[model samples]
Target chain A: MVEIRMRVNGVSESLDVPPWVSLLDVLREHLGLTGTKRGCDQGACGACTVLVDGERINACLALAVQYTGRDITTIEGVAGGGDPHPLQTAFIRDDGFQCGYCTSGQICSAIGMLAEHGAGSASAVTEHVAATGIALSGAEIRERMSGNLCRCGAYNGIVRAIQDVAESPR
Target chain B: MRPFAYVSAPDVATAVRAIGTEPGAKFIGGGTNLVDLMREGVERPGTVIDITALPLTGVEELPGGGVRIGALVRNAHLAAHRLIRNRYPLLSQAILTGASAQLRNMATAGGNLLQRTRCPYFYDGAAACNKREPGSGCDAMDGFNRNHGVLGVSDSCIATHPSDMCVALAALDAIVEVESVRGVRRVPMAEFHRLPGDTPHLETTLAADELVTAVELPALPVAATSRYRKVRDRASYAFALVSVAAALEVDDGTVTAVRLALGGVAAKPWRAYEAERILLGAPATEESFRRAAAAELAPATGRPQNAFKIELARRTLVETLRQLLTEGSAA
Candidate 1:
């Protein structure tokens, strides 16, 4: 077993796990941080998405041992004591989720996506590859969020929520 | 996943030695593909050698005019590299069209080139897939062949290599540098991936003990007018229905040179040499583009559902060539 110590949701935690133990399993089983839902054990569904060093990644695809010293932020760690982030607030205001199982992933992915675009990362739908921070079109948003599936198909509201937060002031 | 010993190799030499000396050991990079495979019980490696921390992540200008891309360079870095964007436009476009943003950020050049097929039959263990289990009698040949290969496919297997970077690299004539316990060797991009002839299991020429060190791309001056066009079912993360990576040089209304490669149609990155031969020195017209595409697609033998891929591949090529010509003329 490999021993890993990392910060999760601003809290430092350490644990010993086998090589096969996934970050999703470690979060749900070992640490009892069950807010991060697991939709698919494979990497297809983004229910287990979490922020690893400020970037979102599918927790199911990342091994627990691989994130020894990195910083992890789960759905539970997004806001302290009920004050939600702007994206989370926009989701609540826009009724972005019906079941709420995929909300955590959606919020985390949006936060990362905003940061990616803010840093001038281009998406597939970006017409000018060299352009910095191309306007986030609806098509771009859907394409970027394809990894995260919503069973309820609440996509229109989710896109609006993300767009609202992205367009809002800092 | 089965129990395995975990060892983090400090460098490429250590990684190669670890794989060479240890039996039933496998190297792990970003673990985007290998970890998922392990979880699904597809690969059962006794030892997991971590090579993510090796000093192999850089995109530097070669001694000559070309670019030397490290094997550990992530797809995100490649897409953002200024030199690659300016010189190898097709490579950047190809990398952007593949997978998702998150996956691309984690996937490396070596892993992208080495990713296995996403064939449904192979993923489903109950189904007979020769690529996954040799002599299993490929169930995909008759059942659900929508995503299977149509060009350069054999009776043994019909799966296509699932990589966008490889399609562009094949067109650019890139070279893969590998380091093994014996020594270092280079494999041309054209010969790197093997067709699933009788041995559908053996995907690439890479030996188990070899670690991919770097990938060198020969500089192409005409690459300034290159493009990568992929036609997929959706606008997002779906795999390509038909993809084209094209670099063309037009001078005085005539095609000076052409490098055309295709994906989602063959077991390997189907380099369209016939198309390139027909296109070189030909007039920059849609008729010539169509003719070249036809010459390339003549050898394509499709199954029941994938017959559309032949026409799709042809039209994709024509559309890409037309766009390039139009872009050149405007410039």
Candidate 2:
């Protein structure tokens, strides 16, 4: 067993996890933070999406031991204590989910996508690839969110929810 | 996933020593590919050396008009770096057209180059695959070989190298820097990946104890106007059925310089040296482009299922060159 310490959702947590255990299992099974779903347990499906050092990644593929001392933010971390994040509120207000199996991953991925856009990441469809940050258009959101698939086909609502939060005034 | 002992290596030398000592040891970077294969029972390493803490995550400019990219640099950071986007846009575009944003964030530059092929037969243990086994027969030769390969097939295996980033690197004439207990060495990207000759299991020239440190891209002013074209089943999050990375420099309507590479076409990133030969000093026109593309596919032999790839690759090359020729569009 490998012992690892990490800050999850702003809480210090230590555990003796199997070397084979993925970060997804550590978050869901060890910490009881089951918000990160395990649809594929592979990198292909983003159902286990979470933020590692403020960047989005597939939790199912990352080894728990590899994430020692790193800052991890799961769906639970999206809403601090009791208040829901603006993304979460927008997702709820827009009814952005159908079956909701991929809701947590979608929300986390959207949060990462926003941060990436804010940092001036460009998508394939962006006209000017040099622009630090491009306007979050519908195409931009869809292209960026392609990692998280919704078999329920609730992409319209998901896009609307993200767009609403993006255009909202701070 | 199989149970394995994990140790985080502090440096490249320690990592190399650890792997050299343990017969079943393998380096894990980001664990995107290794974990997936391990879960599938394909990769069964008894000791996984975590290399995340290794001091190899910097991207700096070299003295000779080139850039040195650390092996541990995440795909997202490399693609979004200002220098990459402004100078080597082809490299940036090639990486961006690759895996999803999340995968890109976790995937490392070195790991992406060493990623295994997505051949269905290779993934299925029940099927025959020379790559998975030396003497085993190849199932994709006649069984659903649509995505197999059109070049570098030797009846042993017909898998294509499934990396968009490597395709661009091949065109850019990048160099791979690897180190081991023996010594450090630099390998040109063109010779890094081996063809599916008799030994399909030996994919690269990397020694068992060697660890990739960085990749260096030599300055090619022609790469500034280069572009990557990937035609896949979907607009995003899909592997390319046929892709082209082309960079052309024309002087007075005659092609002065060109770099061409093809992915999803061969066992390795098929650098179009033959095509470049035909296009160099030739008039940049439809006929010249077609002739050059045809020359590259002259040695190609395809199965009935994958026969369409030849035409698709032809059209992809033609269209990519046409866009570069006329400055019409970008994919």
Candidate 3:
């Protein structure tokens, strides 16, 4: 077992884990932060999405030992001080999900997607690769959020929830 | 996943030595592909050397107008790099088209090039795959082959290389830089990946002990105007059924310079050398484009489920060139 230290949801935690244990298992089993669901266990499904240093990645693909000393954010960390994140509220208002199995991942992925877009990152559907300050069009949101899958067929609502958060003024 | 000893390398030399000295040891970068294969029991490394801590994680400009990308540079960062977006937009476009936003965030440049084929047979332990196990008969040959290769295939195996970025790199005339205890060597992009002849197990020119340090993209002005077109089952988050990476230069309605490479059709990124030769000094027209595509694909062979790839490749190549031609004229 290797001793690993990391900051998850603003708490510094240390644990001894085997080399092969995935971050998903460590978060779910070791720390009991089960909000990060494991739908596919592979990278195909976005149900295990989490933020490492503010960038979204699949937790199932990351080895727990590899993420030493990194700041990781999960669904539990999204809302601060007993208030729901605006995106979370929007998800509920727009009915972004039916079963809610993919809700945590979708919310985390959207936060990262918005951060990437704010940094002027281009998506596959972007007309001009060099253009900066890309407008958050519905097509752009759909393309950027394609990584997260909502199997309950709530794509229309999910897109609408994200759009509401993106269009709302800070 | 099997239990493996893990060590974090401090630098390049340490990483190389760890892999060289330990038997059945593998280097882990972004862990996107390697970890998945490990979970599926496809890869069984006894020692996993974590090299993410090595100081090789940025894109730098070479002395000559080229760009040298570090091995650990993540795909998402590489695509958004200012130099890549402005100079090699097609490369940026290609990287964006592959996988998804989350996977790109976790995948590295070196890991992307070294990723194995997504062949179902190779992943299925019950199925026979020469790549997964030597002397094992290939089930993809007679099995569901709609996603298999049509070019550079052998009877022993028929798997396609599954990287959109490599196709663009091939067209841009990139170079792969690798290092080991034996010292460093530079391999041209064309020679980096190997054809699946009798030894389908040997995928790349990289030896087991060697570590990919970086990939260099040589200065090519044509790459600025290049474009990558991937035709897949869906518009987003799907591997290519047929893809084309093309850059064209026309002088007074005559083709002066051209770079063409294909993906989802061969064991390696199929650089269209025959088509490039045919297009040089020829009239920049759809007729010439179609003829060149046909000449390059004449030697291609396909199985029943994948026979459509030949025609799909042909049409994709022609259409891509035509688009480049139109863009050139408009400019």
Q: In order, what are the TM-scores of chain A for the candidates?
A: 0.96, 0.96, 0.99
lDDT of 3 by residue, B1-331 (tens): 8899999999999999999889999999999999999988999999999999988897999887999999999999999999888888888989999998999999999999998999999999999999999898999988999999999999889999999999989999899999999999999999999998999999999999999999999988777777888999888998888899888888999999999999999888999999999999999999999999999999999999999999999999999999887754111
The CAPRI class of candidate 3 is medium
What docking tier does model 2 reach? medium
Worst 10 residues of 3 chain B by lDDT: B322-331
Question: Per-residue lDDT of A66-148 in model 3, one digit per residue for the tens?
Answer: 99999999999999899999999999999999999999999999999999999999998887788888899889999999989
Candidate 2 residue lDDT tens string, B1-331: 6788888899888999999999978999978888988988878899999899998999998887799999999999999988788778778888988999999999999999899999988888888888987798998888988887899888788898999999999999999999999989999999899998888988998988899999999988888778888988889998888899999889898999999999899989999999999999999999999999999988888999887888888889989999888772232
Worst 10-residue lDDT window, candidate 1 chain B: B322-331
Q: Which TM-score value belongs to model 3?
A: 0.98
Ten-residue stretch with the least lDDT total in model 3 chain A: A125-134
Please give the interface root mean square deviation for model 1, in Å.
3.0
Highest-scoring model, lDDT:
3
Which one wins by DockQ: 1 or 2? 2
Please give, for residues B1-331, the per-residue lDDT of candidate 1 as tens digits: 8788999888888899889888989988888989888877888898999998899999999877899999889897788787887788888888989987777777899888899998888888889989888998898888898887888899999998888889999999999999998999999999999999889899999998989989999978877778888898877788888899998898999999899999998889999999999989999899999999999999889899888999999999999999988764111
lDDT of 2 at B317: 93
TM-score per candidate? 0.97, 0.98, 0.98
Query: Candidate 1: misplaced stretches above 4 Å?
Result: A80-82, B328-331
